[model samples]
Target: MECVWTRNGSRCGEAASRRCDRCRAVGYCSLSHQVSHRSIHKIECDRFRRQMNRADVLSDFPFTFYVEPSKVQVVSFEKRCSFLARHGVHGLGMWICECSCGSSLINFDTISFIPDWLLSSELCPCNEPSISLQGRLSSWKDYCEWRHLPLSSPAAVILHWPLTVYWAIQLATGCNLLPEIKNELRIHYLGPEKELLQLAAFGELQALFPGVRIYIDFVGPAIPDRRSDERIDLHSYALCNDTACRCKTEMVSKSQAVRMQLHAGFYHDRYGEFSK
Candidate 1:
């Protein structure tokens, strides 16, 4: 005669006379409790109805309620190629979904790339790639053009300086030069352009921190080492230049910001380096 449902951190153990109208198997002391439990009880009620309707006694197949599947269509292989061609994305060698907006490409591997609210809609108008595509494409194009230049070339230094400093920061302080500004912060390589790379990094840091005297180490190779009196790496606290690093390899192929955070933790504790 006691209510089967638990309520307010305790069992409803009161006398019960009302049974669930559908299953008639469970009872509740109050109508509120019954209503609150309906969402859960409906599942069991549906199962019970299914079991009752089955005519074959020997059939051991579990009862399953039929629900219509979503009608969203997956893009066909031919359509995918056409979409890629239209967008000028060639030879990526990966499966990508052209977001319904026709403005961005979404790699299938990034499962969480689509937000939950967007997932519920019939089509996802992913605007992130569209917004960032031009900037990234231009950056890559510039990188390719300057990539083969000698590190001492003024052109290479001017173009790839931001990226070089970004990596130096990562190696020295274990912190990424840029953090949390945008989604796509991949650093493109401009070869081994080391001329004035350290000076350029120091200048960038000084500009960012104004009045903070930063120092660069020229021993062996030119790299930003520390501020005049501070032992801490300047890159650790410097505002990320929003440029990508180039030294990153597939083994640690995470966003530059995330990878640097991991590196920072590793330097401090010596145990957090990413493992395969």
Candidate 2:
């Protein structure tokens, strides 16, 4: 594990050999660095502990991909990486950013803190709405409760997308779609490369903005030429094999929530077309 501490604009890339005794999740390259990062790390230390003690959901998967029960339950940070490595998903896309900002300067090795694999992801959940919360969302605990998923559920990895949209819309235009506001929420989702593969994930928007219809204009040059402009009425959620999954329940059945319109072109070149 890499150093868990970063001071100012600097980072300690030294191998983290010392872990926090209390949580046994976070690590440090040295004692001084650990002391330096305590104030910020203190906030999420307990969260790290809670994340470790949760039930192992991997073994419960109904599909044929059955790993050993012992392999599925990972409480150690080193073992967590090893487990992901076996599946070829050990944070391969971690620290990746597509923003126009100075994301290029971000160095993965020297990154300040390494988030627990299942917690806030590259989707950046920490960047919440600047306006009043309106009881829409307060914390991850409440969100997992509302979604009927456990804290250990690997939902945040992808759920970050819908949550990001919820935060972005509010931060930009202060559009808080409270339960009473039964309005159609339209989003111009630009630059959709990987997201196109899992379009169903955006369906979580229905839950994020309950009672409000969401129309997603997925405009990007990555769209296939054959489907340059197409409208898809997302009538249902993706099928799930697990009976315990909410997607398998009536909460998601027959739900016509998200409508998608694909436009295949660069947003800059198609600005005039989109403006119309």
Candidate number achieving the greatest lDDT relative to the actual structure: 2
lDDT of 2 by residue, 1-276 (tens): 667576553556689989888777767888998898888677767866764554243233221112213222242333444444453434434312322232454442333212222222222222212232346563455565555445544435445566667755644344232333457777778787645544655665665665567888878756776666667655444433344533344343334357787777654334445545
Which regions of candidate 2 fall more than 4 Å away from where they truly are? 1-134, 173-182, 243-256
- Residue by residue across 57-121, what tens digits does model 1's lDDT show? 31321111111111111222235455445434322211122223332543222221111111111
- Cα deviation in Å at residue 251, candidate 2? 7.9
Q: Once model 1 is optimally superposed onto the true structure by TM-score, how far is the C-alpha of residue 131 displaced, in angstroms? A: 74
- Weakest lDDT window of 10 consecutive positions for candidate 2: 63-72
Query: Where does candidate 2 clash, by residue pair?
Result: none
* Cα TM-score of candidate 1: 0.18
The alpha-carbon deviation from the true structure for residue 159 of candidate 1, after best TM-score superposition, in angstroms, is 85
